[model samples]
Target: MHSLRPCLLFLLLALMISAVPVSAEPPTVMVADYTISPAVLQPGDVGTITAIIRNTATTATVSEKTGLPGSGAFESSKSTDIGVNIESVQLDSKDVEVISGNYKRVGSIGPGQSIPITFLIRAPAKDGIYFPEIWIDVTGGQSVRQPVPVNVNTQIALLKKPALTAIKTVPEAIGPGDEVNARVVLRNDGQSRADQVTVIVNCSSPSITQKTPSTFHAGSLLRGENTSIDMVFLTDKNAPIGINRVCLTISYVNPDGTITSQDEVIGIHVRGRAKIGIASLSTDPVRIRKGDPVSLVIRLENTGTDNANSVKATIDLPFAGNKAAYVGKIEPDNDAPAVFSLQAGSPGTYTYTLTVQYEDDYGVQTREERLQMTVLDGDATGVVIAGLLVFLLCAGAAYWFLTRKKGPGNA
Candidate 1:
């Protein structure tokens, strides 16, 4: 009976422990930021105070343990969405009077989410600094409490700082060996003035160089004031294509004589161009004659920074052979030949047009030039044959006349 009583007691204890519910870790909530409109309030002015709260947890974890004795027990974990439910938000207005913006029964905020709550309030009748606080209550999470500063016509400045912003204007696209024009505008977006302002431009690429002075001195800039600086840059003939980065460093002196500096980046897109032209022209036979077979070759040269593709040339001449020839690809600083086999026509100086077509990054392009070629009279073989026949006929007539005179003398 004593052994059975102990076993019964142990079973009863296990049942009670299993009946109890397990509690999970609470979600954390914090005040992200707060803003007050009309930063400086008059003695009896009304303004709005806004408070933003957020949940900073990445994920919620729930753990469970199971299995009986000697049954190889293990713990399993699950991920769940744990959101905070806002019950109420109140502003503790000590010196300031609350107008009408207390919130109640506000919804929920998920992890990594934030919400903004606004309250309308009026300033006190005294001209001094006041510290007001906000209290927030959320279900199943840690509460949030934060304090904000309120000024009533006081001489003390909240934050006396200078903020400089740079706005730049640059050409959309630049080609190799081109002169570029650019401008940068410096503006003071702060409440204080900046003195001894200077800007310097720098580029790591040797292909890009500054044409004008690389530094600009603006002297001073008052609050809400802006100034512009003009700059010029030159690109080398072999400058690389694509985006080129240039850095601009700005330095200025604050009211307290402290030097501050910041860096801004400017991107310049450089698209290369392929310059194609006819370098030379030649023929197989130095002197072409009528009714002769000839071979004409046009040398196409690429002098630009890019490659020319699918190059072709055509001649608009009165020839009886092939008129078009394909030159294939011509790389920068290189040349290719386009050849055509033609039959010479009537003897005369023939005025013709030569058209060259190629493609680059800019798509299909064509170049045309007016050219002239002269052909001599028909082959000299025909003239030599006529002279030989005339000589033969004259010799025969002389022979007959001599024979007749000789026969009469003999008789």
Candidate 2:
């Protein structure tokens, strides 16, 4: 009975060990990518190398179980965290000198997480390509290592530069006292990414004022990424009539910590508006008489900044002669005359309409003005009265002469 008791205890220990849960797989880490600043480093120049370390595990917790088959001692599945602790990160120098020390006890990384590790390094005094290896150690997991290529004093280009382009949208033609809406589109056309991009805009003429802020900040632009900025401007009523320039200053930081600037120009066309007015109205003769010829003159003036074309004037007076006149073109701050020849109508005051037509930047326009004129009647009754008085006087003189001659001689 004593010998049997010892064997039974051994069997109980084996059963307990078989029912214990164990991990099926351990967490793993890897170096996803790496970058070196100042791609082409001169001999003895210090630069930085950055690597992205990521955890390959996809889930936060994994189900695990272990048991002896058909022993009726099966264990339920248990969950375990797949987090990885970064023990240390070091850069092994081959032909380059590591300036920054290795990283120790960084922290834990959750499943599918990534972190960037950077180290300062100096190039050796040789004109060739060098390989630098980066080692990342994980606690209770496999270590990760990757080799990065560095260019030292060689003509080979290792880093791709960032290139940016600007596209603008503006109105084809804008007039004074108009609101100008504009847009600028920024695009990254290079292989690398651009950071901290800023844009500033200004107009060349003082007459053109900005309605919004001139500065815009675009945080970051990845490869083949794009952004847009909207801007507004207000033009003065008397702004210059011509092509104006809008200057754009773009600045951004490259991946190598270098600042780059670009200057671009866009044009805004300003068209002039023309305004026409009536300067004066008069006639060639001071006063008009019935059955007489008269000339009516109307002076047209331009007060705006552009020329008025195809100018014509017409009068609505009840006359028999020409009533329409063509003045051709009138320039800004200038005047032109339209003359109409007509015969005087009747006596008393006569009301008429003066219609003026012209073409300007805004298209065809017409204006009407009311005016009045006076005409005097003709003289005919005074001539008949004078003829009757002369006839009576000649008869009296003949009778007196015949009586005086008969009394003095024949009696």
Candidate 3:
């Protein structure tokens, strides 16, 4: 009875152990810890995120059913597989952008294995606290997500340079001794705002000077905002013609409490007013007979701000000697003379055209005036004496005939 009792107890323990079902343990994968390079970042700063992924799953073994060789009986074959495969990785945040290596593939991980995954990210433009969500997708398993906290320090504001342009000028074209009004446009083309902006004009040339205050102050300028400044400038009376350059200095304070300065150049064109005219025209002899020599004189004047160079005068007449004369340069408010000798032709009255041409700073100019000349007959005195003698003889004859004829008729 004792031996039977021992056998029964052993059989009961075997049955109980065989009745329990056997199952394989599942894989466990998670993110253990993470590290960030340059934890504190400013707006538009680039940073890197590195995460440590650990697989805490033990080796899994499964049994596969196989048929026995040449027999209907079946046998069990044991097989072992390890680790979990990671399908993809992603980062989520409106303020952050993934520059590179966003989605990555980790083929498989063994039991008790850890791997590092890296990602490149850019910070937001504004300064504040941000939380970027990082997610890892596992093949045939649940997805893992983690929230990463980032501190954005924006006490030091970013600075953007301002743009300066010349919008318009009151007088499109300017002359010497003329006052010009110029409008300058300033625009903030950068992402950051500027404070306490100022502009100064530097007239390095002696020909130009500022008529009003040379400095202008603009309180604040926001991104994409624009403003204008009006300035007056006076050009010297002796300023030369062509293009002139002026320098402008701009200074502004940034949000970081720093001063920045920049220099720009502006081009201004200066043209001188040029005027030329024929001052006077005269002949040497006031009265002249036929076939007599006459001398002609012409005077030219420059009545404007620019000098007249290469002055010349020409006479258009029937009889003349050396018709053209060189008068040389005539300065502003100055005159030059040209003389020529001419022979008179057989004519009662003659008219000539006196043309004066000159080159000035602007261009070539010409002026024409009428010239009148009179010529008398050489035998005018002799003919007048002969006619007087004939008239006296005829009057004497008529007086004697009248007295004699009256006596005869009375007898």
**Residues 45-163 of candidate 1: C-alpha lDDT, one tens digit per residue:** 99989888887775766665554534436545576778888888888877998897788998888889999989898999999988878888888766777888888998696657678
Report lDDT per candidate. 0.85, 0.85, 0.76
What's the true lDDT of residue 406 in model 1? 86
* Pairs with steric clashes in candidate 2: none
Residue 22 lDDT in model 3? Answer: 39
Candidate 3 per-residue C-alpha lDDT over 1-411 given as tens digits, one digit per residue, 9 for 90 to 100: 887998998776554433212356577678788887777788889998888888777767665433433343354545466678988877778878888766668678887888888879888898887888888887777788888877777433333454433344445567888887777788877666888989889664689888879889977888788889888888887777777777788887776778878887666778666576778877767677777787877777788877778888888887857788998888888887888888877768778888878776568888787887777775588888899989888998999898888896697
- What's the residue-level lDDT of 6 in candidate 1? 89
- Sorted by TM-score (best first), the order is 1, 3, 2
